[model samples]
Target: MPSDVRALLARHLPGREARSLVPVGQGLDNVAYEIDGELIVRCAREPDPEATRAEVAVLAAVAPISPLPVPEVVFSDPSAGVIAYRRLPGRPLHRHPVADPRRLAEPLGAFLGALHAVPPASLGELVPLDRYPLADLREEAAQEYEAVAAHVPPEHRRLVEDFLAADPPADPLAESPEEAAAGTAGARLCHNDLGAEHLLADPGTGTLTGVIDWTDAALTDPARDFARLYRDLGPEVYELTLAHYDGRLDDAATGRVRFLARCALVEDLAHGLGPGPRHYADAALAHLVRTFTG
Candidate 1:
């Protein structure tokens, strides 16, 4: 199989041999192999042709514009559900503490700023940004809540719902998930799956080196990016991220960010409650208490 993958790359690359190929990563959506430990070859685990094509198109367009290193689709064959690209440096951010969160925030903010600034029209036939209608998110949140309703402590269930439904708090630190669904922030291209796991980082330097997984990329509320920042690193990092951004997210936009942040916690706690750490649930509980009391 390594020989086959290498042969595939050879065909596309012409002169360069894609060597030392070995399976390196596997997940729900993709199974990846590193070639010479410098390049990555991936195949979609499912049958999603449109997504395969869009990922290639989006990467090709964004790599040149992104402030951080992004994968280049060195070779792609949607018909075979195969793709190859030069791997960027660093391990996944989730694997290490961002040593100096403050310093990393500056570049991360710049990276997202450049990402959002990309012209969506240039994305061509790739999936466009989702509007993520207020109604849809509300329904999704309700569904996620229902998924875990049985496990929530009886006393905390109602409070959970309120947090999901309330408007942004008058205070920036306090707010509801609903307000996050509705905010004044202008929409732009977003990495719909910009999670901590997707952020690649240099542990030695405490700096992010790359952003990955654009299969779900689209133009959506900028808050989606902000929300992930809030969830993965907490509000302090989120604030630093925003402070470094070239764009401005007004007060209403902040309401949305806070709400979405809370929603992220609830969605996880409510629907995925067994056999894993409760860190997210704990965070959600703390925010819920702060929201209800303040």
Candidate 2:
């Protein structure tokens, strides 16, 4: 543990000694550490501290209303850019291989639906939608695709460009104006990155025990949350999960799902081709093409 980390922890959790600081896992923008016994500390790597503060605030606000258990922010010091939370019980859903995806689908979908049901008025000021806009995502994809096009095969490059060129769907599933609004009224407190890794589940029951990682939490389109399920789990599981949520394969929802799936694929591709690219990019791209075209 860094000396700075010890000092930071000492400031918030006074008296108690921070026994062992072990690296927990890699986060998109923050480094996570499992503090002594039950506490988890997240520190910002970049200069920006707002993200940490926002996460703390959002978690605090949503803890009472959220259907599934959320980590409680026990200690937070935005200046030090470190936030501490009481670690919940159970392991992330991804930790144990899910033998039957259907069994887990209902609980996951219902949990998400309940989360979306939280009135937007309840959540205070959240990050703007423009920050996570589909247009911005598309632009980023185009830029990243151009930069890495040379390394990609000619055939793959053409296909990616063509996919990028296709316009995104306008109709969204959450029809209520409140549901449509990104940050203000329509936006529910959303766990923007709801992957298996973020979900804690009981191995025996296959039920979601807790939802972790609030760094990307925002008040945005509920469909974005559903899109996450589609991308992380395959189509069959995705369909099952949506069905569990009473989500129909309507044209509007389907179109939006297709668009978001493509966007997520592009996002994954951009990150995958970064310094030490991961192999999952190929799978994401393949899935994107199949879903969009089919």
Candidate 3:
């Protein structure tokens, strides 16, 4: 696949030969490579030419409008489900912890504001609508917790259990509890999988260089993206982010953010103890302590 990818780059972007092709990351849906440290090449695990084409279009539309750096596609081969983008600078926030996470507040806030401001109707057809059911999220979290419970710290077990037993907050945009539970009120185009690993930053300056991996980008609950910050960075950063955001999310939406954050934390914790990178588990464990104690 690397050889194929190199050939694709050579063909589409002639003269930009890859000197070193290093596997940087792999998720369930895609595998990513860094080409000579200047470019990122991602190939979908499942070949879907149409989806790859749509993603290329989505990146093109978003790059101009986003306040922070987003992927700039240099080469794309929809037939091979491969896309190459100019590499954005900075290390991921998870692996490279900043001295002050609060530094992320303003830029991240402004970035998300710009993203959510894009008219959902503009990319409505290209991106899928993700109404991740609240019931399903909770049930999945519960199951994940059970699978990794023995690895969880004794001090945090009670809090984890309590969160699992509690009901999720009602969807602010939904008309009724039933509608909320069914997740019928997703209202904005969101980076549905925003998390520390995908957030790149300059470790020294605490400047967010980019938000990567838009594979899960969708029209979903606005709070969903915010929840990642809350879960990974804590409340102060979350609240500061809200301050800079041009859009208003009322108290109910804020509640939903907290609810989703806790749910996501469980999944992170499980991932940490599972097959994911060591930093994932480390970050999750630290977040767990910071969340309840700080």
Could you tally the backbone clashes for each prediction?
3, 1, 0
Q: Estimate each model's TM-score.
A: 0.76, 0.81, 0.91
Higher lDDT: candidate 1 or 3? 3
TM-score of candidate 2 against the unseen true structure: 0.81
Query: Ten residues in a row with the worst lDDT in model 3?
Result: 175-184
Tell how far residue 219 is off in model 2, in angstroms: 2.2
Alpha carbon deviation, residue 21, candidate 3 (Å): 1.6
User: Candidate 3 lDDT, tens digit per residue, 1-294?
Assistant: 889888888899888778899998876678999999999999888878988987888788888988888889888888888888999999887778799999899998888888888876577487887876787889998999899888778978998888789888765576457546755464677888889888999998888899888877887888999999998889899989999999756568877787788788888777767766566667777788556433
Best by lDDT: 3
Q: Model 1 scores what on Cα lDDT? A: 0.70
List candidate 1 stretches off by more than 4 Å.
1-23, 121-124, 149-159, 165-185, 267-294
The digit string of per-residue lDDT tens for model 2 on 184-278 reads 42345568888666878777777677888877877676667777667666566667777767433345665566567666766666676774236
**How does model 3 score by TM-score?**
0.91
lDDT of 1 at 32: 81
